[model samples]
Target: MILKTYRWSFVVTAVGLVLAAWYGLSAHLGIGQAIALVLILSILEISLSFDNAVVNATILERMSDFWRKIFLSVGIIVAVFGMRLIFPIVLVCVTAGLSPAEVIRLALAGGDPETPGTYGYELHEAHPTIAAFGGMFLLMLFLNFIFGEKEHHWIGPLERLLEKVGKLEYVQVIVAGAVLLIVAESFATEHGRTVLASGLAGIVTYLLVNGLGELFNVEEHLEHGEHHEEGAPARSNGPTPVARATGKAAFFLFLYLEVLDASFSFDGVIGAFAITSDPVIIAIGLGVGAMYIRSMTVHLVEEGTLAQYPYLENGALWAIGALAAILLISIEIEIPEVVTGLIGLAFIVASLISSIRYNRAHPEEAHAETAAAHS
Candidate 1:
């Protein structure tokens, strides 16, 4: 049912574009050219986001159905609008003192080589800043993977404390309120919005990203070493399914995935300034890319791909952390999107292939090896 729904939606989007192309065709614009532009952009976004989906699947597999549903819906909204649309405008407004409208104009000017800069700054000049953002975002993702608490070990007092706080219904709400207040305050202070935006961005990113993780229960996979067993496997006559996360666990897991997704998208949006700035074009391009990434994630999860390639999942987590670090650093220096994306994709692909080879070489020991790693 879900697959059918997704396919139907995809078809509808495609058909709508076709019809719209006819109108553009009538306006002296070549229909083929417009369609090609959309297709090319879509593919670029999807290819760049493959690593994101690989990482996302590792997180989503730990989520319950309820939260997964929310992720597919609300999460996309945040990705397309909050991160891609609103974020760039906010950045431009803070750094350049340009209104969103002016920023949009600058973005449109991106295609005209005659214009010296987009919104008064060359993309090459901005590359360092973008790189810094991607680097910081990626670094954090890598740390979470390498330094994450092992599962066999007790979470001790710290986990218990956070768990207690997490149990409170009002805690996230309070945090959310604080974030909004800071955003407002930053907007009001002259010349301080940049710093304010950075701080607020971190806080919001942390809340939503971590919130999703907690909701989806992916943290469970990270907290427990791969070797630890909570209990004996259930004995079933039929094929057994991977354990599904539920309730609070699922919600948090979903939240974490979304947060990570947002972090991953930071550089892409900033890089997109090099493309057309028609807010509509930018939104459509990035939004389509986000859709494809989500679809890819769901496909991986449903197919039990992560269970098949455990190490790939590990690599993906590290990549996510790395990307997070990249985002934080981008606030200071721009990084080339191509380099940032290629590095992440390389790690995931390498890990996945290694896992495949390892599993093939030691079929009988696969489960044992996986369980041991958990511990």
Candidate 2:
């Protein structure tokens, strides 16, 4: 079962490692050094993105098989090529007024002693804008998840309090906007205007993408005239069939997932510079990690892990919020990527332990919840 489930991931990882080794060898580095670097980079990406996998699983579980296939296949292409490789080049092209080819050259020339304008240098210079946009986008995501009503709560009092506050329509947006403005003005002093503009753009992007996805869902429900029975298990042996017009809904969902992944990738791309400025190495390493994350998402969905561990999603969302706060703070001070990653890991572990404990204490309740979800 494990081999069948993760067969593609294994194949991709093998190919990625081979490519990484070849790239390192071509650079005249020792074979062992090249292998070590690739291994470390892959591990770094995976550790940093573990919470991302949990959150992705929550959404993936709700999607149809068609969309799931697209997520694993097309989604990996976008994550690897689009975000890991092309996104930085495009950023340089737009921000530095260089051609795509020029940016590629700079990326290739990243560590050269004589190259005055390396891609890594330019990318670092662009950090303020990147941080503002990604930070606000993620902050909004965190706020929406935390402030939204949830039937199950991991940290009962805190989640309950947030849910009560959630009744104030758009309160989460208001709070996120206020925080963005404060950060732009207080922390981003010299680049305050730019930060504010980028932050607003992030907020707008989140709203449009998330809003469109939600609209598609509403439309789907209206067309089918079927409301999911409250307390019904979200998973089942025979999933409900989607509507004939599911293409549009699925497309929107796909867009949402892509954007979500992009938001997460911002930090990974930036943090990668600290390890090595070589864009090729970063891309290969993170690409392998992305594949693993995709595999884990599929595993979680296929195994009904979320239904079994109800609080896992809560922990992932909390971790997202923490990471958003760290991103915002990092704009002013250099926060180690390990610190950011650890905060997320801690939340996930705590939540997982909580889930296990809950299951043990109330096996009947857990069983009933699972049955309801599948029912």
Q: Relative to the unseen true structure, what is the Cα RMSD of model 1? A: 9.3
lDDT of 2 at 369: 66
Error of 1 at 65 (Å): 1.3
Error of 2 at 158 (Å): 1.8
- Write model 2 residue lDDT over 231-322, tens digit each, in one string: 66432111233442256666776787788788888888888887788888889888888888889888877777778887888898889889
Residue 218 in candidate 1 has what lDDT? Answer: 45
TM-score between candidate 1 and the true structure: 0.66
| lDDT, candidate 1, 1-375, per-residue tens | 466436733853575367437644764447775565556556666766787888777667656677777777888788878877676666666556667777777765544423555642543333333333343334434433343332211224653354445445555445434533443354324323443444445555555556564434445545543323566442111112345666666666665676667666766665665554344455566777788788778777676666666566666655565565455444444466776677778778877777877789878667765564344
Worst 10 contiguous positions by lDDT, candidate 2: 235-244
For every candidate in turn, the CA RMSD to the true structure comes to 9.3, 3.5
Best by TM-score: 2
* lDDT at 231, model 2: 64
Predicted candidate 2, C-alpha RMSD: 3.5
**After superposition, which runs of candidate 1 have C-alpha atoms over 4 Å from their true positions?**
1-9, 12-16, 19-29, 104-138, 149-204, 207-249, 275-278, 321-336, 365-375
